[model samples]
Target: MPAKIPATVVTGFLGAGKTTLIRHMLQNAQGKKIALIINEFGDLGVDGDILKGCGIETCTEDDIVELSNGCICCTVADDFIPTMETLLAREDKPDHIVIETSGLALPQPLVRAFNWPGISTQVTVDGVVTVVDGRAAHDGQFAHNVAAVDAQRAQDENLDHETPLSELFEDQVACADMIVVNKTDLLSADEATTLTGQLKSDARDGVQVVKAAMGALPVDVLLGQGIGAETDMAARHEHHHHYHHDDEDDHDHHHHDHDHDDFESFVVGRGEIEDADAFTAQVAKVINDHGILRLKGFIAVAGKPMRLTLQAVGPRIDTYFDQPFGDTPRATKLVVIGEAGLDHAAISAALQA
Candidate 1:
C-alpha cells in the first residue's frame, strides 16, 4: 500500500561534476536519508570511497554501495538488479535514492534496466540529471549533436564505429530530465551562454538546462522530479541501441561489450608528497604529456592529517581534503585512465617521479 520510492539517476561524462553535484545534494538534504549507489568503471573504486568518507551526516558508509562492476549498464542482471533489491529490503529505508553511473555508461540502457519486473514495482526513476563540463564544451572537446560526433574517437584508436565519448555524450543529453552545465566559473560569459544554448537545443523539449559552478544546485531542484522515467522512454528516444536483444523478453546487456575496449585504467601508488603544489604541477604535466583522460585518487601529504583527494579530467584538476588517516597507511595512490595503448610504464614513472 506504500508509494514507490523515488530514485534519481545522475549521469554524465568524465569530470562533468556528477560526484560534486551529488555531494552538494547530500550536503543540503536537510536531514533526509539518501542512499547512494556508486558505479565505478575502474578497479580502484575511488569515487564511492570519496563519498563514503565525505563527512555527510545523512550519507553513512552503511548507506553507500560501492559497486565496481565492469560496466553498470552491461551487468544489470548480475549486478544492478540485486543491488536495488538489497537496498529496498533493508529495514531502515532511505528517504531518497541516488545512483551515480560510470562516466562511459549510456543512460538509456541503465534507465531501461529499471523496468525489470522486480525493480519497476519498487523504485521509480525520479529524474535523470546529465552534467556537462562547461569549459570543455566551449573548447569543442565535447558536443551534444549525436550526428556530428557519431564517427569521432580518440585520435589513435582508429576504430570504425563511434567513440565511447561521443556516444555517451549524445545519449546522455537525449535521456536527461535536466542538464547541468558545471564548471561555469572556468568559462567566459559568452562561452557559458553558447554552451548552455547548444545543450538546450539538443536536449528534449521541456528539459531545462541549468548552469552551475562546482555542481551546487538546490536540493529541491535536483530531486523530486516524479518523471517515472522508465515508462516515458518512448519520448526520450535513445540515440543508439549499442546493444541487441534476442527477443522482446531477452534482456539488453553486454551486446556491445567492445564499447569500452578503447579505454583503460590502472592505479599508481607512491610515498607521501612533501610539496603539494609541486606535485600537482607534476601531475598536470603527466596528464598533458600522456593525454590521460581521468586521474583521481588520494595523496598522503606530509604534515597533513587529512589525505588530499585529487580528480582530473582533461586539463582541469580539483583537490580537497575530506577525512584524516587515522590508522590507514599513508601513501599516494591514483588511477590513471586513458585510451588504449597508453604507455602504462612510462605514465606510471612520470606520475611517480
Candidate 2:
C-alpha cells in the first residue's frame, strides 16, 4: 500500500489573508506538486480565481479544484468526500493537498472527514492551519466592521447560542494545529504583542502562534506538521455546535439549517470603468454606505487589456492588475458579501453612478 498523502487544511475568517498565505506556500513549495481545494462562501469564486491567476509555476490548472456550492464543512459528505476520492484516484497524485476553506467554515468537520472509509486510507490530516487577521483582532472584530457584525448577529432569528461570528472565530482558532496571525504590519508594536498574547492563550497548549505580515511565512513552517489531526478529534471539538456533524450521514440535515443563512451574498455587474483608483474609491464609499463585509471581483478597465482586481475589507480596498482580459468579456462584476438584507438595487446603482 502507498503512503497516505499529507493534507493541510487552511481555515480562517473572512479577510484573514488565507489566500495570500496559501499563495506564498505554493510559490515556495520547493518543486513539490501541491493541489488546492478552494471552498468559496459566496456567489462568486473570488478566492479560487485569485489563486489561479497568481502565476505561481508550481500551481497549475490541474492542481486547482474549487468547491463553490457552500461551506466545505456543511457539504462534507456530499462535496468533500467525492472530491478527495477523485484526487486520490488520479494517476498523478499531488505530493501535498492544501484546502483553503470558506471563511465561515468549521475546521472540525472538514478535518474529521479524513476518517472516512476510502479517504482515511489515502490521506492524512497533515495539519489544520488557522490564520487570524491581526489588525481585525486589534479592532475587536471577527468579520470586518464591529458594529456591522453586531447588527447582523442581532438580526439572526435562528441564533440560539453565542454570537455566530465570535463563535466561528473561536471555532477556527480552537481547531488549529498552528495559528498564523497575519496582517501584523497594520498593527503597532504594542498592539501586535497584545493581540498575539490573546491568541496564544486561546489556542490549545503547545500550539505555536506565529505573527506574519502579507502572509510571508515560509512553506516549512506552514506545512509538514505531520500531526495527523483527524485522530485528535477530542481536543479539537468545534466551538459552535451548529457546524460540526456528529456523523457524516447526518450532515445533510445540518446543511438544510446551515449557519451561512446568517449572511447573504450577491454579484453585481457593471459596465467598463475608466479609472481604477476612482472606481475603488467609489467602491469604498459603497462599502461604507452598505456596510459590506467583503467585496472582491475582477473589473474590466476601459482601454486596458489587463483585468483589474478589487478586494475590500471594511473601508480598506486594494486594487491591482492581475491578468489580461484577453478574449474574456471586458465588463465589471463584483460579488458583494454582507450580513443578510443587502439592498442589491441600491448598491448596484451606487457603484454604477
Candidate 3:
C-alpha cells in the first residue's frame, strides 16, 4: 500500500490571515503539486477568489475547492469527506493537501474526521496551524481585557462570562500544533511580545508560538510536521469537550444552532464609489463603531479598471487592486461578519453616506 498523503489543517479566527498564509504557501510551493480546500462561513467566496487571483502557476483554479454551504467542521460527512475523496481519486494527485477551515470552526472536530474509514488509510494529518491576529489580541478584541477576565473567573468560580468569540478563539488555540502570531507589523515591539506570551501560555504544552508579519513564514517551517493530530487530539484540551465527544458518526446539530444565532453575516452592496479614500474611511468607522469582526470583499472604484479588494481585521484595513473587473458586474460588494446585534441597515446607510 502506498503511504498516506500528508495534509495540513489551517484554522484561525476571522481575518487572522489564514488565506494570506495559504497564498504564500501556494506561491512558494517550489514545484510541488499542492491542492487547497477552503471553507468560508458566508455566501461570498472572498478568500477563495483572493487566492485564485494570486495567478500562481502551480496553484490554479482547478486545484482549489471552496466549501461555502456551511462550516466544514459541522458538514464533515456531507462536504469534507467527499471533497477529500475527490482529491484522492484524481489521477494526477497532489503532493500535499491543505484544508483552510472557516474562521468560526473548531479544529478538533475536523481533525477527528481524518479517522473516517474511507480517508483514514489514505491521508495523515501533517499538523494543525492556528493563526492569531496580533493586533486584535493586543487590542483585547477577543476579550474585554484578558487579565480582568482571568481574575474575575479566578475570584468567582461560578462566574462564567466567556463570550462566543473568546471561547472560539481559545478552542482554536487549544487544538493547534503551531500557533502563528500574524500581523505583527501592526503591533509595537512591546505589544507583539505581550500578545505572543499570552498565546504561548494559552496553547498546549510543547506547542510553539511563531511571530509572523504579513503571513510570511518559510514554507518548510509551516508544512510536513507529521503530527498525526487525529490520534493526539485526546490530549488537547478544548472547552467544549464535556458537551461533545468524538463520534465520527454523529452529526453536529449543536454547531449549526450555535453559529447561526451567535454570529450573523450580511452582504452589503453598492454602486461604484467615486471617492475611494472617503469610502474606506467610512467603512473603517463602521467596523469600529459596530464591533465588526471580519469584513472583506471587492469594491468597484470610479476610474480604476481593476477591482479593488478590501479586507479588515478589527480596525486595521488593507486594500489593493487585485485584477481587472473583466466582464463581471462593476459594483461594490462586501460580506460583513459580526455578532448578532449588528445594525445592518445603519451600516449600509453609513457606507452610502
Q: CA lDDT, every prediction?
A: 0.73, 0.74, 0.73
Candidate 1 ranges with C-alpha deviation above 4 Å: 143-161, 243-353
**Per-residue lDDT of candidate 3, residues 216-300 (tens digit):** 6656557766678998878777676311101010111121111133347789999999988888899989987887756789999
Q: How many pairs of residues collide in each model? A: 0, 0, 0
Residues 209-229 of candidate 1 have per-residue lDDT tens digits of 777776767675577666788
TM-score of 3: 0.62
lDDT, residue 109, candidate 3:
80
For model 2, how does the per-residue alpha-carbon lDDT over 131-178 read when each residue is reduced to its tens digit?
888887778775445453344334333333354567778878888878
Worst 10 residues of 3 by lDDT: 244-253
Best by TM-score: 2
The TM-score-based order of candidates, best leading, equals 2, 1, 3
Instruction: State every prediction's TM-score relative to the real structure.
Output: 0.63, 0.64, 0.62
Determine which window of 10 residues in candidate 2 has minimal summed lDDT: 246-255
